[model samples]
Structures are given as structure tokens and as C-alpha cells.
Target chain A: MALSIAGAGRNALTEKAAWFSESLARGLKVARAFDRDQPKMRISEVAAKTGMTRASARRYLLTLKSLGYVGSENEWFYPLPRILELGYAFVSSARLEEFVEPILQRLSEATDAAAHFAVFDNNETLCLGSVFSQKLFGFFISIGARQPAYAGSMGKVLLAGLSDTKLEEYLASVRRVAHTKETVTSAAILRREITEVREQGYALNRGEMTPGIVGVAVPVRNKDGTVASVVNANWISTSSIKAAEIKRCLGPLREAAKQIEMRLASGAVPTGWVSRER
Target chain B: MALSIAGAGRNALTEKAAWFSESLARGLKVARAFDRDQPKMRISEVAAKTGMTRASARRYLLTLKSLGYVGSENEWFYPLPRILELGYAFVSSARLEEFVEPILQRLSEATDAAAHFAVFDNNETLCLGSVFSQKLFGFFISIGARQPAYAGSMGKVLLAGLSDTKLEEYLASVRRVAHTKETVTSAAILRREITEVREQGYALNRGEMTPGIVGVAVPVRNKDGTVASVVNANWISTSSIKAAEIKRCLGPLREAAKQIEMRLASGAVPTGWVSRER
Candidate 1:
């Protein structure tokens, strides 16, 4: 998947301006190179993953260490606490959490499931808010976790609500890697599913992202009817009542979406604050 | 607070390596310049906060905008969704969430109050895990949030666990800004409270961080008897049973800490994994 991910826009960084610093971009990438799968990376691994030479990667990593962004044990590098300031500034700066959180509580309680609110960030789904489920065997994720758009229910819902041009850009940029047996890895199949979501006004996932976990979602529209976010309720499906769960969740899910829209329209959510979900 | 924050190591960046690129560090700083109170910044404000020259700040901010890290409304710069990736990487990479979360849930259930686990992140306390209270008016904070080492209860416990040398470094590095009227701004007073925490084996706060917010925290230790992290239970003290509440929560809180320590000592959490949570 060398060319597969890199060419497919595996996770886009904003296009550099004429004056944009490539070193800065690489530095941020070095910071991000440490995640759930590889919390610590050897300098060579960082060099390979970031596509930087060993010397370049070492310099960046060492600089990050001095800046308190990177911590090391032997040769492996991991992020430190000060790194949280970057993402915290992003979410709280939007102030979307305040209004979206109460709605998340209501939606989660009413449906008795974990709820998530996410917006489109470049080519991936950026989770802005999450309320944990009461179920012992539920899918739990943090607010800042990112997932691909074509595979996850929240991603599909947000993608379905995008404008024609934005949708085309997203489809063109996405990597159709199969995450599970149920994942739609073909761009044509995904496009069809997204179209159906646009028509049906909701999106549903049955083990597409994570096997045995089902998710149902809807788009939250801004006053201008543009998609501000996609909110979802997820559960672990050990039983056979998949249809029943979807049927039960859609009503509250849509209701919560409307409440969010009403609040957004009422000016509690600033107009033009959130860009297009993409 | 122009020179105040910059000189105080406001948002520390690693010092430049002999070959490290300062532009990368400045670029990351440009992304963080946007926050709740100043979500949108004019060009001058960016230069002022980052201490970059006007032309340099504009170039970095423009570069961040092109990269989708920042957004613009006319001339003001705001952070976009991409910034979430930074903090998210830090928390998930540690994987402490899985082990620490259940303890938080159990503790919250036992006390019917908010429960949190934090670790020493340099001079600040980084909240590793949190289970929100069912109370509508409880003190709610997301995981990965940071508080000063001298002010909050969790900060005090973590700081108290440090060695003499490390403690001296922290005391010297910390800026004792008074957030609340009751905040301990004097170095002598803070040192005394931290020493008391070491003696008593826990730390307590009454309207220190926030006027009506009271917090009680204890340190979580590893097998070798070094502190791994600090855990706290907090509530809104609208009622007068502050003394009784602390006493009631202490047993369950300490038990939760032991449970966490046992888990950490049991090899579920990798040794040499959390090197800096001293």
C-alpha cells in the first residue's frame, strides 16, 4: 500500500502556501506519527513513515524532544503532555462542544447507546464529541479519534451531506482500503451507499468499520442547510435484532439532529462557524 | 502577559537542535495561537502571542490556513478541525485509557461524583482518564485537559510525588498565576501544601481551582513504589458537607487507586512505557 495510501491522500495535510514551511508540516507529522498502534517509534521508523531521511527525521524528532512535544526511551519516541494543547485549542476554539454535549447526553440517554458527533476534517472524520454507552460491551472512542469517511456510519452521513463538488473531491481523494469483510472498498459501491444515505436521510453500518459493532447516524444541518456535523449512536450487536436496533435509534437520532439544527439556527451555534463537513 | 507567558515557558517548544528546524516549531505554535477566548486572531495578535515578526507570523498562519490547520473570516485566523490530531495522538498512544477507564467508572459509581486519573506531564498535570458524574451541575472536564502544578488538587499530588531535584525544577519552572482568589500563588505556600500532601498521602482542595469546586486526589503508584499517576474525585460544593464528603469519598478513592496500581504492577501496562509520569 505504498503508493496506495500516499497517492490516495491517506490523510491530507492542507496544501502548502507559497510561504508554508515544509519543516513545520514535517514536525507536526512527526508529532502525529505516534498513535494507538505505534505510541513509540524508532528514529528509522519515523524516517520511513514520514518519508524523511534518517538525518532529517532525527533532527525533527530531537527538536520535538527539546520542545517537550516528544519523549524518548532508548531510541523510541512518543508524545508528551504538552501536545494536548494543539487539539484542545481546536475543539474548544470552535465552542461546538457546549451545545452539542447536552444534546449528546439526551440522545445517549434516550436511546441507551454511546453517541458521537463528528465533522469532516480534510479527508477524514474528526470526532468533535462523544458520550460513552452504558452497555458493558459497547464501542467506546475518544473525541479526537479519526476514521475514514466511506467505511464508518458517521463518516458516510457527513459525506452524503456534502456539496456535489466537495463530494467529488472527497471521492477522488479517499483510499478504498477494506477495513473489514463488510467494508465497501470500491469507490463505486461507496458512492452508491452515500447517495442512498442522502435520499434516506440517515446512514447505518453493520460491522463495516469494526466487526460486530453496528452504528446508525444522521447529518446535523446548519441554518443554511449545509452539513455542520454527523451524529451517531452505536452498539455491539450480539443479538439478531439489527433491524430493530436501527429502527429504534433513527427516531431519536433524527430528533437530536433537529434539536441541534434549531440551536444552530437560534444562534447558539455561530453562523458560518463550522466549515463544510469536508 | 505578552512577555509574561513567553518568558514563563507559556507553551514550551523544544529547544532547537543543532540541525533542527525552528520554522517547524513556529508553525506548530501558529496553529495553537487560536483558543476559546481568542479563537479568531488578527495578524498582529498572532505575531504578538507567538513572538514572531509580523511577516513571519503572517507566512506561518497563511501556511497553516493553506494546510487546513487554520481557518479565516476576513483577516482573523481561527483553528480548523485538523488541530485535533495533536492531542488525540498523545492520549491514544499511551493506551492508559483502557486500563484506567473502568476504575474511573467504578469509582464514579461508588461515590456518585466525577472521577479522574492524571499523570505528571512535565510541569503540568495531564488528565489521563475521566468518568463524568451524573450530577447536572458537577465539574465536567474532558480527558487530556491540563491544570497548573501548584493550583489543582491532582497537580499537587503529582508534584508531591516528584524527587527533590525534579520538585525544585518544577517549582522554579511554574508560574504561580492566581486563577482564583484562593489560589496558592506564593512559592513557599505551594511547597508547604505539596509536602503536606506527601505526608498525608492525598491532596484536597476547597474552591482553590474554582470557587464552588472542591477536589480530593491521591497518587497511584507502580510496583517499585514510584508514583505512576494521581487520581481525583471532584464535585460542586453547593452543599455544606465538604468535610463529610471528602471522608466518604476517600476510602473508595484510595481503593480505586490501589486497583489501578495493582493493574499497573500486574503487567497490563508496560514497564518503561510511562517514563515521565513521575
Candidate 2:
């Protein structure tokens, strides 16, 4: 089906799309080559990762540079801050704050932990908004950060929100690699866990995605009662604060999620309502 | 020269040029149509703003959407969060933060006010980052927001850092619109203010940009002693916290800026330092 669509697009753009045709694939690859770990790249580095010629990579880099999306200093190329404007534009305008951010903030303050609001994109989860606790030693995940959907507390909650058929298809496709010793790598185990998550109306992860990190997540439903996103609070566990304490934190987390759902239902979810359409 | 360049660009593309001429312009226009204020737009809105047909806008939107740079929901479109990956890719990786964010954060804390770090971009000033004090009543400006270089404390500080010739040219080109009652509008007054700001090692705004707000700013110097950006702290003046209090806050603000400068000299800036690059 994907091949047929590509073939049809090719036929449709034969004469007019030639300029973009060659660079489109290379551009997408170039964008993917940039990540939190490897943000800046040399022409050679980009070429190696994207499997493009150095010359092609250079062209794309220069093009991006001219567009003010990339910066070059002393021969090393890096993505520039203007790129954040794109994300900020969406998130800031999306009125998510009216519904989501305050709830996340209150949850973080209540639990004294980092709280995150995340949505599913394909098989991965993207953190849309986040609030950091005042505590010095809490989970500090940057906004716009991504993680696999099968692993963490918020990821599992979002995954559970999917239809059973879609969830099964996703499980079949994923490798379910263990992130920590306690991570559920088996598809059957994950399926059962997601079922429980759905039944209990929340999900929990203890040292699953990251060591010493414990979290509980609940889905934020939309006006139609469909799950829109997952809100999670993460904290570092010591002997003083065990899994049970973390579970106790879930009550405020769920309350905050419910509040956000009510805000969304009231149509107060900010002007840039991209999540609703997605 | 500009007209000649435009004419040359209008000429036929080289055989190496891959995309259709109109498609390239349409794509660029679609990308440009999004700004800090209007980050998301419907297809008809984009068409209206870019002066392109809805079909052309849809084509560009689909192309960008496929690349993961643009996103859409229920026919409403927005730039995506990954767009920040580009800007942050450069800033997070750059040494700019060694002398920027820390100073701003410390200044904010010391003053119990809001501190901003901004850099010059052409004729405007772009906010690199800001740190707000724990106090509830502080200025709320995001990291990527832009302001006219001729107005505001940070803007004037950055303007003072420019070369004399460039400063003269920019001053000639700018439209000195008054933002508040105390805004400096006359060229002679502004020139004198800039000169004083240069000599005093800081700039002060007494309710110039926004009424009831007072700001003090100092330039952050790079390793080569060139002014890289400006750091400013903002506070509200009432009977309790007068202008004297605001001026007193500059002491710690300057010390913080100096510490950041030392960090920049030591080249100890963190990896993945994304902030406003341009």
C-alpha cells in the first residue's frame, strides 16, 4: 500500500516535482539524523548516518542553514534555535495550558516530582508538556523528548488507550527491549499489563524505563471520552519512599488527569488544538 | 543589488535544480507563514496568508507533514515539536550558554524578579533564554520571543554592543514607535542613551517597553571580549519595591553575568545547549 502510494505520487509529480523529488528523501533523513544525542553533525557525519553522499549532505545542510534552521560554526553544523519556534508555536498556542499544564504543575507540586503530559505518535510517545518539581533531585526530562510506547508509565497508559486490535498490532511489531531489569519485554506480559492498566484506569512503572525511577500515569480523556494523552508523575525512590508510597501518589495524579479531561471537555484547551485532530 | 538578485533568482533554474520553481516558493512561503503568534493555521488561513491557492498550500503542508516538521489535526495545521529539535540542536550544543542562561537564572533569583538573556539578530533582538524568580509577579517572556532592538532594556544593551557603523545604519532604518509613555522615540535621545549605556556598562528602562515594569541589563562578553548577548532583570515597582530596589538588584546581576563569561572562557558549556540561536 505504501509502495502504491509512492508510485502514484511519482506519476503525479513527474514533471513538476523533479526539484523536490531527489531532496525530499534526503531532507527527511537529514531531519532524523538529528536527535538529542547527536544534535550537531559534520558533513561527513551526516552523510554516514543518512547514507547520502557528502556533497548531498552539504547541500541539504547549506539549504537548511540558509533557511535559518541550522547553524555552522568552525566547520561543525548544528541545528539552530529557530527550530524550537516551530514546536513552541504549536504548544504555546494550543491552549493545552488552559487544560493540561496547570494540572501537571499541581501534580508535580503535590507529589514533589516531575510530571509529564504525553501523546502517542505512531508507535512512540512524545512528551507534549512537562512540569518540574521544586525538588533538586527529581526526574528531569526535557520537553519534546520521545520514548518507546511499550516501556514507561505514561507510554503504557497511552498504549492502553488504543483499541485492542491496534494494541495487538503494535505489540506484534515492537521488539519490547527491556530498559531496566524490571521492564516487561515479553509481548504477552505487556498485553496483560496493559489490560490491567485499562481495568484500573491507571498504569504504574517501578524501575522499568529507568533505574530508581518510579511513576504512575493516567489517561486524560477528551470531550468524547476518548483518551487524548497520558499524564504521569515520576520520582526517584529511596528506602523511605517505596513502591507503595509511589502508588499513593497516584490519587493526586488521577485527580489532575480528570481535571485536565474536564477542561478539555469544556473546550478550553487553548487555540492550537492539534492533539484533538491528531 | 537586491533587485538584481531577485531578477537572477527569477531566471530559469539550472538543470541540477530538482524541484518545480513554483513548488519551491510555495513551500518556503508556507513555512514562513508560521510565526510566534500564529503558529498554527487552517489550510484556508495558510492560503490566505501566503497568497497561494489552497491546493498549493495543501501540497506544501503534506510535504512538510511527511517530513515530520509540520503536523495537522482535523484539517487544522501546526508546526510540530521536533521543529525545536533544530533550534535546540545548535544552542544546546553551543558554548553560548556558558555565559547566558546561568547568569540569567542567578540574576532572577538574586533580584526576585525575571531575568532575560537576549542576542542581536539583524535589526531585532531575540530572547535566548529567561529565568523567572519564584515570586508570582514577574515578567513572562519565552525563550524564542523577539522584540524590536530599539526598545526595552535588553534590546538597548544589545544595540549598544553593535559596531558604531552598523549601529548608525540600524538606527537609521528602524521605526521608533512608542510602546509606552516613557519609550525613547527621538533619534537624538536614543543615540545619547545608547552612548550612555555603552559607557555605564548597563542599560536601564524605566517603564519603557511595558508600563509599571523596570529593567536593568548588562552585556555578556565572549572570550574575545566582544559582546555576545545582553542579560537583563525585570521587576515591578510599587511603594514597597521602588526604582532604588531595582537598581540595587543590578549588583548581583552583574556578578552573575561575569561568572557566565568566565564559564564561556573556560569552554565548559554543556552539550545540547539549545536556546535562541538567531
Candidate 3:
């Protein structure tokens, strides 16, 4: 991404954005510094993480602190709830959260399992919305967590939606490593699984990505029948799940996917509709 | 808030933050224009909503489009998922999510009802985390959704946590309109309810905020014996709720609150430990 930005001449997107207020980007970067791994950062630490000098970091931190985005305590600084407005804008604008949220919650409530809606971005499954059941303890999953697309049921359902050539290209380039004893390691076996998933209209995974966790996924399609995302349900236990147990979820999961498809047809998705419709 | 900001002199927090990046704030304002009511907007609409000139709004929109913060479809523009990084920072930074999440899910799983953790912010309750049940169609509520502090069980629990002076002053200024026929409109009645809540250690309400919902909230305290937030469970239906049903939830709700208090004492809350602990 940086290479493309640098290679482009004047009037490039990055150059134009940085033309007026560079501090805007800097302030945003300061806000971006906090994430799951490093939620709290010291003044010196922000400087190191973002490659800004200590003075520059301090000035921006002080600016953000005043702006209500950054909250300071002793030497450590963290973000406050107001920062969520930024994210809320995206969720509201896209209108994805409104439609997917209730469906996922309902599925979780019905099955007593963790339910999720994930989109295939780049090569990973980005969890957009999730409702976890506390049957045991849930895995460390949160909204926006990315999982490998090659080793899970949700990813497989998404992969099955791709055209033949794209699917073949993905299989050729993707790293085929076993995440667990039950993971499919060979390209040939994964290709067969994807084919089966396409025929069955769902994917079932038994301890593939994480040990002791089983998953089932179905594809949510656009009006044109192209896949937009995947709806997944996960059970966190090593006990072998009977086929009937996994089958019991198929009807509700497909119902949700169809409802999402219907909603997407009515201009409820993030990816533009009217333009594509026209 | 605006008066205090204007009264402060040069180098005040707000002033310093605004000095370098006024347009940044304007861009943020434009992004916030998208909400549940209006998820899409045109350039002219954006200008009207944010009071930015068409030319300036165009520039920032173009910059955001290039920066991947905004997506354009037809003539309307909307925010993209990249904005979520801003809010994800706060959720991660506090680290409260790691502990509170499991307990909320457990409560929801057990009760088959919506369970939420809300903190008193301004004159409202800001939902920090929630696990919703699919028992009935839920109202449009999100993680950051705020409810009036005078109208709901969650709000009353937080209000009951305040000191005598603060509570009196809050009651004096707050606009108390009846949200439902059963809402406590009289300040004296509400005060008595809060006092009873303080004595019993929890609050229960039926058809107070929404017409058909029954709610019970318990206060989660810090080690210093101050209330930090409220844990709430809501049952949806117009059916009259008996005192015993509300009573049944208290034991589990209080248990979860105590668990949260224990976790908060072990360095779990967002506020800096040294300052708050002191």
C-alpha cells in the first residue's frame, strides 16, 4: 500500500490528504496507537511506537487529552468513550450493524453458542458482529478480530462463494499449515472441502483452527447470488458434536443468511447498491 | 461545557487542541452526521448538517474518501469500517471488557434476557457492554446507547450511588418527564425510590422507560465502597411482573456485581488506579 502511494506522482490520495492538515493524521495516528495488545501507552512509548519525537508526541497527546479522546493517568494514557463516535459513524453509515446484530443475537440465544457475522477482507475473516454464549468460557474473540481464512468454517463458506479461478488462485498462494490436529493441511483436501461446502450450502469445522472448538458457517449472499459474508456459530468444547447437533443449526443459520440477503437488496449494505443496481 | 471552554484563556486544553486541527474537528463533525435516522447524506446535506461550506466539505470528503474513511455511492457518501479503529482503542485501553464481558454473557446465558453494564455519564447511563436475549424483539439499543438517568432501573441504581448533596442538586436540575404511564414523575417520589434502592442495594422498575419492559439493576462498587456502574437485566413483555420474579434476579445480579467489584479492585477499571484509589 505504501509503495503504491509513493510510486504515484502528485495528486496521489495520500499526498492530497496530508496537504492541508498533517496534524489531523498525526492525531488520528495517536488515537490508533491503542488496540487490544497495547491499550495503554506512556508518552515515551507513543513516541517510539509512532516514530514521532518525544516533544511532538507530548504535544499531540496533550491536544488529544484536551479534546476528550485521550484520558491520562499518572504516566499512562488511554482512550475515552468519546473515541467510539468515530467507529459508530462507520457502523451507522454502513447500516450493517443494525441488520446483522439482532440476527446474531437471536442465533446465540437459540443455540446457547457463540454466533458471529464475518466478512472476508484481504485474506482474513474480520468479525463484524458477535454474540457469545457462556456455555463454558468463550475464546478471546472480539468484534474486528481477524482469523485465518484457510482454516475455519466461516472462512470456508466465504471461500466457496468465490469464482472458480479466484478460488484456485487463493488455494495456490495460501500457506497450508495445520493450526490443530484436525486442520486440513493439503491444498487438494481443502479444495474438496470447499466443493462439498458449495454443494451443501454450508461448512462444518471440527477443531480445525482452535483445539476443542467446533464451528458451522453459512454464506450470506447479495441479490445477484454472490456471497457478501458468512454467518458462523461456534461451540467451545472437545466433546464430539453429533451431526444432528450441527444440522439443527443449519435451518436457522440459512434463514438469517437469507434475511441478510433480502436486507442487502433493499440498500442496507455498506458496499454501494444503487450504482451496482443501475 | 461550552461556557467553561470559552471562559478558559489561551493554552487551555480545548483551545490548544483546536489550534492546530480545526478542520479535523469539522471532519469528525461531518462523520457524526450519520446516525440511526440518517445513515446516508449528500454533499449539500453534509454542508447543511455540519455548517461547513460546500467547497470545504468537498475537500474533506475527498480527503476522507482517499484516506478510506468515507465511501461514496451514487451521490451519497458514508463512513467506512476504518473509523472503528478510533472506538476500538477505548474498548481495548480500559481492559475492562476482558473481565466484564464474560460476566455479562454469563448473566444473559443464565437468564435468557438482555444483560447490560451501564455507567452514569452526564445525566444518562452509557452502556459499556451488553448481552441481549432473543426472547422478544428488542428496541434499538447499542453498546454506547445512553438512557435517561431518571427513567430506568439502571439509571436509578447509578443515581442511588451519589452522595446526599449531589443527589439533591441533580434532582433539582434534571428535567423529569414521564417516559411511560408508570414513570416516576414526582421528584419526591423518585427520591424515595432512590433511597429505598440504596437501602435494599438494588432497583427494580416495570414499564418505566419502555411500556412493556421490566428491569432490575444492581450497583457495582469499587474497593472504596463507591458505586462505579450498574448491572441490569431486562424482561420484555406487557405481562405484569410479580415482586418474587424481580427478587429472583437480585441474588444473581448482586453476585455478578460483587464479582465485578472484586475484579475492579484487582486493577481492572479504566480510571487510573492511583488517582481513583487515593
Fnat of each prediction, in sequence? 0.68, 0.18, 0.46
**Model 1 ranges with Cα > 4 A deviation:** A1-18, A164-173, A186-189, A240-244, A262-278, B1-17, B164-178, B186-189, B240-243, B262-278
Which one wins on lDDT? 1
Candidate 3 off by > 4 Å: A1-7, A13-21, A91-98, A109-112, A134-136, A162-200, A239-246, A268-278, B1-20, B93-97, B109-112, B134-140, B164-178, B183-192, B239-241, B272-278
**Cα lDDT tens digits for candidate 3, B145-180:** 667888888989888988888788788888888888
TM-score of the A chain in candidate 3: the value is 0.77
Compute the lDDT of residue B227 as modeled in candidate 3. 86
Ranking by DockQ: 1, 3, 2
TM-score of chain A of 2: 0.84
Candidate 2's displacement at residue A117, Å, is: 2.5
All candidates: TM-score? 0.87, 0.81, 0.84
Which whole-number lDDT from 0 to 100 does residue A159 have in model 3?
83
- Candidate 2, lDDT over the whole model: 0.69
State the DockQ, from 0 to 1, for candidate 1: 0.56
Report DockQ per prediction, comma-separated: 0.56, 0.29, 0.47
| lDDT for position A268 in model 2 | 56
Docking class of 1: medium
Q: Write the per-residue lDDT of candidate 2 for residues B1-278, one digit (tens) a residue.
A: 99886777656355325432334335656755776466678989999998988787777877777656677778778776555444445445543343355556557767777778776764677776665455534355555666787778888888787788777887788888999888888888988999999998888878777777877888888866677777888877642335577578778878877876776577555322222222
Tens digits of per-residue lDDT, candidate 1, B1-278, equal 78876886533534433666889888878888777778788999999999999999988888777667777878777777777887877778766567777788778878877889887776777777877665543466666566777888888888888887888877777778888787888878888988899998988876677777878898898877888788888888754336678788899899999998888788664344354634
Candidate 1 lDDT by residue in tens digits, A55-82: 9899899888877778777877878766
